[model samples]
Target: MSKKLNMSRRDFLRLTGMSSIAAGVYTIPGVGGVLAQDEREVTIFFWDGPPLIGIREKALAPFDDAYPGCKLNFTSVPGGPASGYNDKLFTSLAAGIPPDVFIIEIGLLPQFLADDLLLDLKPYVDADDYDLSQFPDLAIEAYTHEGGIYGMPDNVASIAIFYNADLFEEAGAMMPTAQWDDPEWTVDDFFSSCEKLTKRDGNRTTQYACDVTGWDKVWQTWVRIFGGQLVDDPFYPTECTLNEAGAVEGLQFYADLRWEHGFAPRPEAMAMGTTALLQTGQLAMFYSGSWAFPNFREVDFNVALGHYPAGPGGRANYVYYYPLVVPKTTEAPECAWNLLKFFNGPAMETIIREGGLQGTSFAEQEKWFVTDPLPPANKHVMLDAARHFVAPDPVLTNFGEITQIMQAQIDLLMIGEERDAKVVCDEIVRQVNPLIKEGQWRSG
Candidate 1:
């Protein structure tokens, strides 16, 4: 009384127009076990930058060859110096026209997740048995929440001290170790080198030892080195811990670089910003992320990479990555997932290699990165530093607001509007804790 069903591989392939055996095995709805012949168009949203240029020029061609049936429609959004991109993205989402895939910075992931904006990628990842072991642990950990993987990392980067070799040689200061575990390369060593490199003309400094331009996140690394935390826990921050003794000391040390040591630049003193200053040989050293590599290569000065100074808490730096995320409302989740895998996977490797992206997230790519003929000839320093990176506050969804509140107090201290580090830390705790509590209460 049972009916016999028969289907050949060729018959299935002909029915679905699928190019792969795997595609034929996985069923698409309404087609039984056959893949659909209809071409799927996936829209991707990403920030417009130099790297995007490389991606389009180098990565896209290979991706097309690999998956001809899937069409990629890219939309470049503006970033940096303003915050319009997020607004635009939110508007698109509200209008029910959100891009299938988009880039989400690690700091913004919590906010996006809290709003239920991202699709859980766990199902796709598990179905394929994707070898996530190829990526750095920190990179994977950043996008994971509540047993769900929301995205895959596009690139990974961390903060490091970039120094001018000419200045260091002229000052007779010992160069910082490129090795993370170099015992002698401590905070004291960093300060000592800065002291020696600083050049002053009477009351005016001709050349500063360092530029503390973007110290908001940089300062957190220092706090960790000094055995302190900006909050009770970076991932699940319930209360501000900047008022702790170690944190106060770390902040005090940072403030001292400008107000006390007279080596680091003050806001008014930096006219052309860190890039120009470093290029012109006016600034000896500055703390910045690996994104500076491309621009630094264009300059005429001799630049080398140095590790973030080790501290009592052991070596520490903030690790960050922008993940390629799929929105929950995507019309073609399967096609979007395919695009995400291809773009962040092997097809994108050539783009990353040629683009001079220093901190690639893939383990296999690390060898290529280190061997590439690039400045900071000691490129291995970044890989070493990655071993000790600290993930940022995970539970705090209101990063933008909290950062603004904390920065305001820090700015007051930096500009002499406030003097005492302890007082400033106390003020930050008083102001930011309420915001966190309010957010938690509302969510609850």
Candidate 2:
């Protein structure tokens, strides 16, 4: 974590040359008195995780310095168990005390939007003449609902394959390319390479060709590549479509790698987990998000990034992002807006450069993203993949419940409890569709 400075408010104001302004007057660097405002606190609720806490603190420093009167209070809640953080947010909202600013994952945006929990940022953008074009189209579209943008895109990432170069060399297997247009780098080639790289000793396998998690996002890339989608429309999903032929085919291919082909290791096979296997050189390739870059960089093995293998859908991948939004009940909307803009704009560039995790949605910052001594020499591959990225199926409400249900079925399939992909996916639809309908009814 970044060390906090122990300076008094008076000393900080003195050092920063910020003097108290009279009521009904505003002060900025060059701008004179403008809007009428008073000192207030803006509470921001965001997820807690490694590197993120440090990164957020570093990124928020500039905003903190600029807006001294508007004290920024941040609450970091643990992510996952998805219900945990959302419960806290809802409880706060119910009590008529909502966060001024909060982070919303793209997957859960629909539920928040349906509940009227977020403030529409369109008016603010138009009034300020903010260039929405600065962010990627997909990133912007993810937070857009019925023509109004509700959130500011903060962090964007695309799924890709991370490979151990040394393992490839040892196995006499061809290394995958970071180039998206590589004709030879198809799914067939990827599977053949995995076959060559996988090795066994007696009944116990010494090394695996690839490792993938039961996480829906990681495996969903394959589904999209096979020309399938989990829902009819990601932005406005109404029904589950996992039982479709294309989706079933994709899930079968994913399952076969573990059960039928034995090319990918099962979760139980790796006692220390997939990351440990990758670091120990026992795993050749792994599919994950851009956030894994830093973790892989720390390992002794030489790591390189590779594009997702092309399939019938033509190199499809999954894209995800965190959006900064204001609740409808915020007491300090203007201050929250200023902080949100800073977080999505200037702070993004800093995060990309210093954090070395994922790239920002801003196009101009692309140059800063791919540069430097980062482990994956071809970091641009992730940005390239973003062009063909797919968003998660929109679960209109009760997103956490729906995801849990789907993931449970996926877990059963992965662990050999269910052999048929179609059966598992069918079961998912049966259990999840009613919950979605019930949620829609409640929201209605």
Best by lDDT: 2
Candidate 2 per-residue C-alpha lDDT over 69-131 given as tens digits, one digit per residue, 9 for 90 to 100: 676777878663274877887787788777899877666677788778788889889999988
Runs with alpha carbons beyond 4 Å of true place in candidate 1: 1-37, 54-58, 80-83, 298-301, 364-368, 441-444
TM-score of 1: 0.86
Worst 10 residues of 1 by lDDT: 27-36
TM-score between model 2 and native: 0.84
RMSD per prediction, one decimal? 8.6, 8.3
Question: Deviation in angstroms for 195 in model 1?
Answer: 1.8
The per-model lDDT (C-alpha) reads 0.74, 0.75
